[model samples]
Target: MEMVLEFLGNIPWWGWILAVIVLVFLYDILQKKHTILHNFPVVGHFRYLLESIGPELRQYIVANNREELPFNRIERSWIYASAKNENNYEGFGTDRDIYEPNYIFVKNAMMPFKVENKHPNQKDPYFLACAKIMGEGRRRRPYRPASVINVSAMSFGSLSARAVESLNKGCQLSHAYHNTGEGGLSPYHKKGGDVVFHFGTGYFGVRDDDGNFSMEKMKKLVAENPQVRAIEVKLSQGAKPGKGGVLPGSKITAEIAEIRHVPIGKDVLSPPSHSAFKGVDGLVEFVENIAEATGLPVGIKAAIGKLEDWQALVTIMAETGKGPDFISIDGGEGGTGAAPPSFADHVALPWIYGFSAVYQLFKKHNLTERVVFVGSGKLGFPAKAVMAFAMGVDCINVAREAMLSIGCIQAQICHTNHCPSGVATQSKWKQRGINIEDKSIRTSFYFKNFRKELLEMTHAAGYEHPAQFTMDDVDMATGDKNMINTLADVYHYHKVAVPFTGIKDIMNCPHLGGGYEPKKEKKDVKKAIKNEEVRY
Candidate 1:
């Protein structure tokens, strides 16, 4: 050791540097994994470095404030400001193209009224309101959701344990509900907040050893987790509508395997359809049975595709007087942990058209008042939430934005288990970057500020609460539809009246007899809406 020290001390520092560079070059030249490295040796390292940091450079330097895909800089900045409790107000006028096609605007009241402040007795002053869901017969118990903007499903296997813990604690602070994604329940989900346990076709947490649905396991979960406020049966997600949930084998750790009841180092694929139900009638029956067994509110999460299929479900509900307690509609633009490009890109309806179709259909069946509606998919911004409300969605669920609040950089590498921000990966070393305490606080702050902004927009639209916002409060501006029309008009919600006159007179009444049509129903049932640039 002394001899080595003496030799090093005798050698020049540049000599040592040169020696290390030579070693690195030799190693690169010998390695075959990377073609660039093998071809260009040390010089190729620069290319790899540049490629690794390319996303950052494009995000911060090259891309304009509004040019980023998915979520732009302006949107991300708003979330960051809310998370940090920093001022997000802009100094100059709007940079957006307000007159651009598909541009949306709120119909501000001529004399905007002041909305009432939060109740003093409320646990969290940031909590603006709550929505109560009550079911009849077996599902008689009522569950009141405290927040309109709650966390959407992002599974445990997909997100780091630290991220789940932070989100749960944040939900507790903000009085928001945290959804246990279809991956199933974990101890981390019970940190300190309300939960909505989601069940995909896989039947994860409540599945038997045979990977079949287990009533006993479900009862056990409900019995043990009092924090679970509701259950959502996921028929389909907006992203990868028909595809199943995929958890790569490399991500399945011992803990995840146990939680999900799947073999370690084995790829986990959830079935595309539930085994408990075969069709719409079976679906309704399944929901009723689950609600009766759990004695809690049960809902269905589905991406709209077939308009007649939705109509059939509503029609069945009208006939049987039984249906899900709530319906959560996911748009095609919604995010996911992992999905195939074909399913993610081509399947399902966008939130606007989907919500409108379902909403009007429910109104036609006189079942709108009985069921709650939740809108999800790219609704991270206050304006988007308000627009959803105006379109008749009772509440909104946010997935990616919540991830962003806890320091996600939109690396778009979530599926690789190499998330740079530590929000999605399961590796312990990578997960350490997310400080649960700090990120939890940031999450709470973001939720509070978002709700605050939503209320502000609600008041601007002459509504005390977002729930009061109607189709009249929203307008869509585009080149094709130049004039501002109420959402009701755009979605075609024509009114129909039935007179109490004699049967002979009723038969003679043209509107009631056959002319009564709310936005002329399409007669081409055989022809499906073609998947094109503008999908319904």
Candidate 2:
């Protein structure tokens, strides 16, 4: 042993370093989870290390200011400036392509109406008004929403405890509401902020052992948490319309399991549709039931698809006069922690289109007075918020922007459960990077500046209140000989047409194959008419 120790002590420093590298290379080859590491040994770690920082590299170096997906550098810079309450002016003019299709511009008033020049009040604006839902139910009186842009549906399970705490604290300071996205109701949500308790297909906070909605549990929840200002029943989110919400088992803690009433270490799947309600009638009744139980305003959140289906729901409301107090319209461009590519990309209508269609429906049926609209999906800026208001959305919901305010670096690794920025993971070590107090202050500042800028635009448009903005205040840049057209001219009406009738009436359609058959009744239709009939 003394001879061996003497030999090791005699080794040079370079020799010791080489030996350590050789051992690590052997360990890498022995590992099975990563095929790259197995094939390349120690050299492969560089790929992963570089991949981990790939987003930052692209954001800062490779990608130009305007050439990024989901969000660009220009947009992110504005958010950062607002969060820090710093000057966000560009040195030169915009780098945006003004001649691009779908470009938007706000029409300023030549002679703007001047309201009292007052300090940015910082008071929570009474933005929305709710109608009475249930009769003689001992419910809390409906209070006006504090701000136009409030935190959107971000589940507690998708974010760490510290992240949720900071969000709640910031919301409390800003007099805004924090939405408890379909995960479950947790203690971290009750940090003195107004809460919007959302129920997805899982019914996480109010479900029984059999995974069914429980009225008794809901009643208990209402009795305990009076800070819950509203309830949002999520029909579908824009990012993944027909897919259920999936929380990987690795992110779930024992406390999360208890809160959600699920088994520990099991992936939690919220079904695509609600089990508590069946049809339109059933849905209206469910809304009434929750409103009655909690005495708080109730609403539904959905990504718009199947125009007929949405019209039918609103028509029933007009007929029965019993429905949700508000509707949250999610645009197809909305972000998510995780989603299937097909559903996220091609399923639902964009925010402006969905909002316009839904608004037209409400107006058509004369139900606009009863139902308020909350528009969501990438609405993080003042101009975008104004555009939504101009199109009849009562308020807006900000999710990604709020995360940015509290230090999400757009790493886009939220689903991996290894978010390096500490805003979207369960790892205690990662969360330690976040300072709650500092982030909370930044969140409040971001929200205040957002509201202030929106109001400024409202006043510049010669409108006293943002709600007064109409189609005349905004334009869609067409980039034609005539540069732009008012929103009213572009989206004047929701045209109704007979869909797929052409296919049914075509005489000997060129596209027809031998398998084609006339559309007929189920009783008369058969896959194969006789035993001799062949089918693919």
Query: Clash number for every model?
Result: 0, 0
TM per candidate comes to: 0.84, 0.83
Error of 1 at 475 (Å): 1.5
Residue-level lDDT of model 2, residues 1-536, one tens digit each, is 99999999999999999999999899998888999989998889899999878878998899998898788888988998988889877887777887797788888898775755443232334222111121212333343455566889998889888888888888877767788998888998988777888989999989999999998788677656656667899999988887889999988999889999998888998888989999778888999888776566788999987788778888888888778887899998896569878887898999888888888888888776566678899987988887887787766888988998888988888888998889899899999988988888888888878877777787788765666777877888877777888887778853221112221232222211111213541112222122112310
Residue by residue across 170-288, what tens digits does model 1's lDDT show? 98887778999988999989888888899899999999989998877876677666677689999899888877889989889999999999999989998888887788999998888
Residue clash pairs of candidate 1: none
- The alpha-carbon RMSD values of the candidates against the true structure, listed in the order shown, are 11.9, 15.7
